[model samples]
Target: MAGNAGVSKPRTAAPAASWFGALEPDHAGDSGDDGGNDAAHSRYDRGEWRASDVADSRFLSRQARRIAESGQSGLYRLYRAFVAARAALGITLLATEIAFAWLITSHPQHGAALVLCAVYALATLALWLLPNLLGPSRPTVAARLRRRQWAATIGVDLLAFGGLQLLGGLLNYTALLVLPALMAGVLTPRLQALGVAAASTLIVLLATQWNAGVAGATPLLLAQAGLAGAGLFVITLLAGELSGRLAREERTARGSLAMARRQAQLNRLVLEELQEGVLVVDRRGRVRAANPAARGLIGEPQDSSGESFALAGVAAWEPLARAVDRAFAEGGWPEEGRDVLLPRDQGPRQLRVRVRFTQRREARVAEDYCVLFVEDVRTVQARVRQEKLAAMGRVSAGIAHEIRNPLAAIMQANALMAEDASSAEQQQLTRMVGENAERLKRIVDDMMEVAPGLVPTPAPLDATAQVAAVCSEWARTVQLPPGAASPLTVELPAQAVGVLFDGEHLRRVLVNLLDNALRHGSRSAGAVRVWLGVADDLHARLGVASDGPPIAPEVERYLFEPFFSTRSRGTGLGLYICRELCERYGASIEYGSRGVPERHRNEFSVAMRRALLPDSESRPHLGP
Candidate 1:
């Protein structure tokens, strides 16, 4: 409701032509269907077909139902007011008859008139005191009974006034009939109101003729009674029209209120879920509303206890308070947003603050409030850095494509030269050329894999065999002896473990991890360990651990980030490429310490989903 002050009023209905536009039939479809078109036109002329009878019947019915439902409260209040008015009128009528009976002793039916007046007063009082007595307990039944109750009330008023007028001679009781006529017009339909007016007019004429025949009155008295009846008809018509207009306005106001509430709820939901901070602050630095992100940015607790706080209350928020004050002082927001630094015990937090004012027409300066949009500078910088890295990767991928052909030619030439070399020095030179060319080729392949379209097709592979073969080859190449005395230790489960991964991609990942371990390990027995086992029924785990110093916290943060490494000679793409390949196969790789407390070692581990076996095999079998 607070934010809904600016909601516009509901629109009024369109002109008559526009309202009935949908009732027109399609001429295109009617060209070959003259008989049906004529029947439809006849129905329309006879007033049997309306806009509601057209294709929008459901829409009209729903709108009518909503209007009836929304009007129930106002209807109940009006009914109560009418009941109270009837009771007062009944009391007044009874008092007037009592006074007349006391003053007129020759009147024969004065006593009977007093008795009728007393009974009518009691009946109206009972209905006023217990309005629900006329209706049943169920809502639908009560609604139907309540409608009839209005007619019954009007009828009783007419009968009581008519009886009193006939019994009392020359008392002029016709004025009381106006009350019933007005009540019928306001509470009942137009046809019902007109019927009540006609019935009242008939009763007046009958009473006047009876009195004239009994007392020999003049014809001029009959003319006065007719004029009185005409006045009642005019009053009923005017009251009915005003009441109908009032009901329409009430329904429109209710619909506007409901729409405003829904819009406010939607705005609150959007603000709560927004990533950027939003705060509404007044001129005195009081925070009217603060979203979750804003509380987090300002280091305020997120629990909403409904207690109010000011920005000036927090020492670190002084800069923000000053910005709000400046916006209010200048009577406008800054063209460029300013940055504010909050000094915390941990470090200074940089925030970009943009302000906008909520101003009303002819509003005082104190009534205006400012909305602040806050964002973290570090997050903005990180997003920009990621975009730059993405552009650099695209350029590097193109360069890798260009180097691929020449690098392959160089490797082929070096192999041919090695075969022709007779001298040891010449052979050594050719071997170096071949090794360097192969290294360059591996770099190019890794770069090319960074392209977005590359998708690896994974297949079921024996984890135990892959780890065993990779570890054996690596140990042999490093010239480490195979036994308990070897620096490299390889462990595998007795049962084969299967995983979903591309064979060559898995081989490349394992080779990279082993190379890093060997380069960093102390080269002692059991210094480098490789193990393959089942993590769970759904996954297989592979880990490589080495006796190396714990990586620094800052370096560990960027362990898998591209182009980041502590070693000056390191390309930094090795670990990055390994992570990319693992993720492609729905696997994850992470670095942590995994050994025992006495001999803690830095470890890199991979978790890959266990491969699904065929129906014939109950479990994974070793692959050939």
Candidate 2:
């Protein structure tokens, strides 16, 4: 009985650390208490392991709970099924026993035989009904019930057959003993199953000798007993083999299911982290799958629970829906990605959408699905623009070098012509040629700012003094209306505050800003102001404000774009060159429109790297 019970013990997998070896992670790896465990330290220091290295703990705990809730042993299920089959066989056995008791001229104890058959039928019915009442329980409870049922069925079968044969029964009835022996073989261990077969065979030999009224054992009877034992042994071996195979298959299936689930989780993680928008839509236009990127691209709120984006609800979505439909109609991907324009309060925004078609099989029917990818047009355009500018810069640099020599020759020749000309008109023409050549040279120099090799040499200088000097010089050079009190006002910090910038580059940038402001600014008293102050701990701020008409938003966007200008005579490279120079020296420039007490003004602000100052205080110099 002990051997038979041992057969029910579940086969456990080998120790995770042993079989997994280098693949397994030790729980003690993170602990410092492992003073003697060299293996643990070695593994931790190597640190070449996968996430699943800890699956012994994580996967096993989860798998255990899952199995407890739903898993059943194959042997238990087969045994339960066998008990049900026995119930049907019981009815047939009862009928056969009733006919035999009446038809045969049986001796004493015929009534006992009939009563045993009836009791046997009742036992089979009880066993079959018991499982339904038990429903599902833990593995331990199921195993207990299985053992109880096995014992009861075997006891009843042995008693019935043994009694019938002992009571002068004509039929051999040895064949009936094989059923209980067979059940024990499959559900019990090898030794227990052989014991059952041996025990039944002994009972058969004793019953046969008694029924035949033999004084001693006969050859025929002995041969019959041996044959019955051999048949029982063969049945036991086959059942054990089948049950072992079933257990192995179940183990393999569970392992495969675990691997598949882990793979699914990995795929989900990658999809969520992707930058590109991804959407999967079915033929009916219902979104089946969407990543965070896709949700953000559509301007949909995170809390919105709508499953499908209706094409008719918004005009902006119609183009995307149509592109998806077109991909489906063509039974492939679209030749070109669709460009969509969405209107917003700021302006019309551009989006580029591409669609790919896929076929999915559901219930043996193929259904078409479209995967839509969305990308912002500005992002794509910006990347393309940068590449184009890089190539153009290289070309422009080469051209600038080539043109400088020719321009110098032209200027020198025109200068010589001015000395040689006799007539006033001829001299005036020569002067005009020199002026235009100088202007062309300035344009080339401005354009060359975009050249990749242009690097600024920054130096530490007093920002307050520089701002005061530049503003005063600019006002004098522009020669503002003399009668109208000076249009320029200077605001500088008291103490000596310094910043890192190329003095020459800074001067040129200030001059370009002042020149542009003068052309567009109001010629009223105190209309222009330049202020210098600390922007932050890291930067020194210089701002130049002009009481000029506020720049239109449309024009402001391209203000610093190379070759873009509002004035007909303007080179369009002035502001661009200023920004380039500022950037090269670890500084930045930006423009904004502001309104003062009496006038609206456009302001240009520059932020430069702040230089460290000494602790000693010097007298403050107030500048106007």
Candidate 3:
């Protein structure tokens, strides 16, 4: 009965460990406790051995569950089939015994016929009841042993039939050969072939011995022997081939299940660790899956009433939920999240919702379940906003201190000039005071936050092309020191795929970088490389390099600080404002020098997320 089950899938160590408590799962091996007789730590347990554990280990638990559930029926069916075949064999034997009794009475061979009937009846009865003892709950080893035992006994029937044929041979019995062939059609092909081969060899030898003095072996007998051997051999080959195919199929399905389970486990782990509240709902709006996150924002417990239903403490939640439902129906998310004003204990608290959906891929047989993924975006946004504000506060205070002293000097000098106490040189000195004062104020003003609400524009803009335009502008007005030259270089990819960004803002960003290259990095007879490229499909990157005096490490560390400078005439807000503006557009800037030895050189790079553009029709309908 068990052998009929064929190949089986491997089991995971985790669930077993949870149930037994003794199995310590690890990367290299499964180390179980041998401390006591407790089932969890039993040393004698056969289940502890991990012979082919890796063959079926899935990171996902859910996928394994699905496979296990579906496989149960197939396994049960195999056992049932074994039991049925045995019952049918028993009935055939009983009828054969009755017919033999009638034949023995007429032929006067009662003793031999009676012995054959007894052996056949006992074997058939054993096959019939064999499956009952080897039920599903039996341990794997026990079940496998039972299957081998019964399967072997079925082969023993061939020996009995061969003996019966030998009895007939002593009496020139040709009728006894029919029993062996009938056995071939009923038993597992492996067993049938072995049985038939044994019977044919013995029976043919006996026939040869009995007919040795004849002209030749009877033609009809030779033909029958050939047909029997060929039939049994072909059956065995086909059965062996089919069994191999079935085993391969079993392994593949098990592998897919293992992978699915492992993935599910990882997803579950990430879901539990997530900081934001998350909840999943099906297409009918029924809650399907939920992580450690709360049902509602700010730790609200979820309530379910069986059917698809929803509730929110805030009225705004309805519209947001509706949007999520629409996105799920649409099959992909266009927008991930949006902030909502939800009522809190104190007052209205800001919260954001991000939702996505995926249908159960394997459950196509029952495609009603939809996996809705939900996350609270409020926490992420709040953290980002707080960091940006703290940065601005520090910059504002520093700029205030830097600009105050210069402002007082300019005001006092202007008052003296108002009294007409001025020679030509005195007037020039006052003019110098006014000029330096304007520069200081400009620096402080530029140090302020990048224009209040500039974000990546929703329209597509080409970063590479933006850098090219800035390169042209730099070429026209750039100046350099002796031995240095303005390098005109822009590496624009052949394909100009645009991203969602404000053209004017990106252009300004490029202009600042280009000017910095000309001012601090431009080199003559030295390599000056500039590249505007995309990195890893996620970020747009721009790097400008030059072989000039390398920037000192100490200065590079604080180069982006507002009002920081190494140049005597610089406003000090150039690099600082450039960085602040880039951040406003979801960009970052990094500065570094080339080599540490002789030649002084630098690289200034900027990066930003590759933005996604809306449809062309929604973007002012720009014509081709």
Give me the candidate number with maximum TM-score.
1
Go through the candidates in order and give each one's C-alpha lDDT. Answer: 0.70, 0.66, 0.52
Show the lowest summed lDDT stretch of 10 residues, model 3. Answer: 15-24
> Order of all candidates by lDDT, from best down to worst?
1, 2, 3
Global Cα lDDT for candidate 3: 0.52
Q: After superposition, how far is residue 248 of candidate 3 from its true place, in Å?
A: 1.3
- Please give the lDDT score at residue 369 for candidate 1: 73
Off by over 4 Å in 3: 1-84, 99-104, 127-154, 166-217, 294-321, 324-333, 336-351, 355-380, 386-624
lDDT per residue for candidate 1 within 1-624, as digits (tens), equals: 100001111122222100001112222221231221111111011111222222222223455545434323333455557678879988997898778777887778777888988988987888777645644221210111122364447777888988977775647889889988887676555666777899888878888887777676567978988998999899989977776666556545445444444566677789999988999887799888888898888887334676357888678888888888887887776556788998878899999888887774256645567889998998777888989989988998899999999999999989889999999999999989988898888889889876677587788887777777777777777788667778787778877677999877888899889888878888878888888888889999999888877777888889888888778867789899999889999999999975446343799999999986443233332211
TM-score (C-alpha) between model 3 and the true structure: 0.44
Q: List the residue pairs that clash in candidate 3.
A: 58-262, 59-261, 59-262, 60-261, 60-262, 60-263, 60-265, 61-261, 548-600, 550-600
Question: TM-score for all predictions?
Answer: 0.75, 0.57, 0.44
- For 298-375, candidate 2 gives per-residue lDDT tens digits of 667333686455444566566667766776666666455778776665777778888765643234444567788887
Better of 1 and 3 by lDDT: 1
